[model samples]
Target: MAETSLEQIRSRVDADWNRIVELLKSKIALRSVSAEGITGDHMKRSAQFVADELRKVGVDAKVVQSANPDGTPGAWEVIGSRIVAPGAPTVLLYAHHDVQPVPDPTAWNTDPFVGTEIDGRLYGRGSADDGGGIAIHSGALAALGDELNVNVKVFIEGEEEMGSPSFIPFIEAHRDEFKSDVIIVADSGNWSADIPSLTTSLRGNTCVDVHVKVLDHPVHSGQYGGPILDANTIAAMLISSLYDANGDLAVPGIESQEPVGGLQRDLDESTVRADAGVIDSYTLAGTGSLAARMWTKPSLTVIGFDAHPVEGSFNVISPETTFRLSLRTAPGQRPEQAQEALAGFLESHAPFGAQVRVDRLENGMGWAMDPNAVATKDALEAMREAFGIEPINKGEGGSIPFIPELQRLFPDAQVLVTGPEDPKANAHSPNESISLSGLRHNVETEALLLAKLGR
Candidate 1:
């Protein structure tokens, strides 16, 4: 694609790998967890760190905060760019500096904030999910420096962990600034540490809060327990109905799409079980190949719920109980449609005449990639050279809602979803990590893709 051969790019990545890891390690040390009711300047710190790093690569980088829907201050974001040539195609490199909250440090074998090196991997919160994404872009830019043929832009958002609440407003307000011909979303993981993949499809995600009421106030269990079921009992019944006996989503009007080209990307059952830490006695649910059940099919999860703590024994029946449902939509369905279908199901399936009310929490859109797109072909070739093997197309059951929104905003832009994460990265959980070699490969891949596209 250019005078800089794959061997030369590999040499550059290897030479600078240590410094890139240090950059990501510093980022992981910054607790940039994006969630509501959180009070701290860590988000700003994360944004500033990304901006400062971008400037080192000759980008006019800055920390930006978008206005909320009510005109209030919103989440932090990092924006930067470098114009190589006037006629060169503009490429937007995407990543998020924010990371998911680590609810329990006790679950980790090492410090969640320290990027620890162990067995050829770097372990810490934000190390893989999007922190690795940031490193990929930074490393690519550093590797290519002045010879980068494409006009490059980098946008690192802060609230991805909060479902990107201000993403639309943030982008809409700066339409021209973010406009590009190709968008590289380095937020997804490869198929495996040894196998590279081009993410072809992703499920959109939506959530609903369900409130169930059976009585006016807490009643004595001795007096009311015999006559009627408690609100918690009723809530359990409603939650139970969310899935069929086989465990597929039982909500109405929701549908699944066959993988593009109708060829399935199946996962090994043993590996799936291992990855999930599934108990040996627990039976796997649903139907079809493991990959379809994961990537193409809808799944329902009870993410949040509130009853009473078991430690405190109370002989009273709860008057009401509230629970939250998280639904991952199939690729073809929109977040709104899935939310509506789920809300309708919960409202209609109340048990024993219990009053049920459903409220929308949040949602994000999903996307499918065009396999034949010129950019996709270029990316595959780049990945093949970097990984030294033919890359495979894979779909993630996890949702990256901002991606579909980007497609909607820039209809003419060709989007490429590539990243440094591997299957065992354990993003959003304790002991999250990124593969060292894989990270270097991704940096090489991005540099190569941009080099090829510009040519």
Candidate 2:
């Protein structure tokens, strides 16, 4: 095998830029949001589209069916393979095809399902989250073509946004097809537009619904204001107690670990404010370095509250209220332990002797990767060459549950968590976008990585 020039790889990706964008736009138009009770033709279509695109680049591809416990078809997973060099290490490229629902269409600058390019960015609900990821894989493989020296396996999942309910089963059913020595999980984020990053760790996650009841029914506030306690008030108080004045999670039994150390590029207050859409006057919560709090500590968020809307407010005390609590457990903490600790804390501290019920929703463990692995070293060098800057070693605050599962399945394999998402790419939200230039650079980086690992 000969040394592949970086210029040749860049030129190949640049030549196929239009085809890549067109492929992404076709996927974005599918509306394959895998929400609960939502299964349909679009999901299969999206998965098939991925397979067909890979086939166009001289790869063998197909859409595999995701199944239920009873062996019923649920969703689809696309798998593609290109074996250029026999006996070479197989690299599995992973991403997802399904996206999140557009909760509010009015908040978007363009149709959430229509991929739009503006100001050197591509905007759509899944544009950056994973549609860009799919393009990156396809473009990288296309760039290498027959010159690729490794056996490549591409796995695109279908239910990532819905927490991958059938992911483990799907993988278990097809374990042989997923065999690989290295996996590049292309569903994470970059530090910024120009700054590449290798995600070093991810936080565990759990959710529980807290229900409180203070009375049998609503009562007139005017007549019982002084004597009665409203369910909404008590629920709000209990939720508030989960965090201290400094914004730290006040729950006990959860554990924390040392943050991943390497790049000192701490997300500043201004960047946080802008990226999170926080008001200027509001102060950031928690303690320690922002990186530490984000990646190494437990954090709780109120996802939703089941209470009466302010629009139809009357002078009455509500009987019951329920709130959904989303907790991000620290890297070392167990989800079951965190769930128990949170539920117990809420039950023991019930305000004014109110009846409390906590229902656990979901749980996922965190993951950490060795920084000195051969594939990791190759990826870092490839990224530096592609982006012309040292890639930052960072950890994501969000959870990618299947990453740990991959590690457990192949303990000796190296897992590289890398993606093209930046701060402005509002994935899982309206008006999501990805930098076009950034996507090109990331594709080239992946191509170089595959070349190096093949050697």
Candidate 3:
């Protein structure tokens, strides 16, 4: 039997679906990619936009800004709204307004920055990855307003895609203002389009840049081919050694425990290969379930490799070669510890007479949610009501750098991660799109969740 409040909210969501989509489309047109070409002026405008939207919903909203101690051009701003209710739990709604770079504009069917609708899908760079979540959260709050009993705090950041570097420091400075009983991170995705999900774990990340110097200068191939050592060859060998023949990461200390549940093996290998754009000459290595390799295990990828180009093949011994290493560690593993292990391995295992330098890059610890938490249970129930199916528990392969920080600051606070995105959303890739059905269900589920939490 449907609860009276839930049925009303669901009906409201259905009635307002078109308007919600229009609002989302407007938000997506901003092209708010936070990495490069993002100015302080643009951030201020975007933050103000969010605050203004919240204000229209009758929530007390404002844009609070703080500058770095070292005089930098940019300032950190948090768009916040608070809903007051007597003796009720305070929940913080967190989402980011920023997005990743939209490269290769020609590859997209529509302008990457201009939101466009095609066959029941909304296509835009940030549509599914985050804009859809933000839209759903905004729409839910707009529809419910002060009718909900719980106190709500909404804080949307502008630098999440850039590793949220400024958010933690700002939060630390204003710890008292951001305190809450629960924090809903509406940034992750469902397992599939139809199967609603809650992300229980996120893998930690460690990046290292390795530079090898084998010669002082490039020399002619015929003159130095046999005698001279190639830096490119040495760099490739180092990268190859990081993975074994079975395609398992050779890095020690990082755990590789398999996930308990199984994955969707119904997906064809051809589809996976096509989506990944894998060359026909090669095949995906490693064994066991794809989810295990993706989420519960350690994986190493050579993200960037630089050397002399083959087009101008002088065939000379290269003077220098560099490669970037990205190590994804399982939950319960510390990123800094993994980075140290990786550095030690690279330093001690470099080939003879080759000067290798390993520089630490960005690192963040992983997060694992308590499955038995009351909020998790409530979220599952709410999802079931909205989707007519039980939500799946899964681990995300990517790292949300600030999640562990939030856990540290608010140890007692319950965290729930759910959103309208799906695997084929093409986040961080060209032609990103969001399913319209996903957006509607997320909005309805969140509204129902508010009523459920109050009860």
The C-alpha TM-scores of every prediction are: 0.95, 0.96, 0.94
- Sliding window of 10 residues with minimal summed lDDT for model 1: 34-43
lDDT of 2 by residue, 151-217 (tens): 9888899888878877888888788778899999999878887889889889999999999999998
Worst 10 residues of 3 by lDDT: 67-76
For residues 64-160, could you state the per-residue lDDT of candidate 1 as single tens digits? Answer: 8877777888888899889988888999999998889888999999999999999999999999988999999989888887788999888998888
Instruction: Report lDDT (CA) for all predictions.
Output: 0.87, 0.87, 0.78
lDDT of 3 by residue, 37-83 (tens): 33466667777776777676666778776544353434445556565
The global Cα lDDT (0 to 1) of model 3 is 0.78
Extract clashing residue pairs from model 2.
none
Ranking of predictions according to TM-score: 2, 1, 3
Off by over 4 Å in 1: 1-3, 36-40
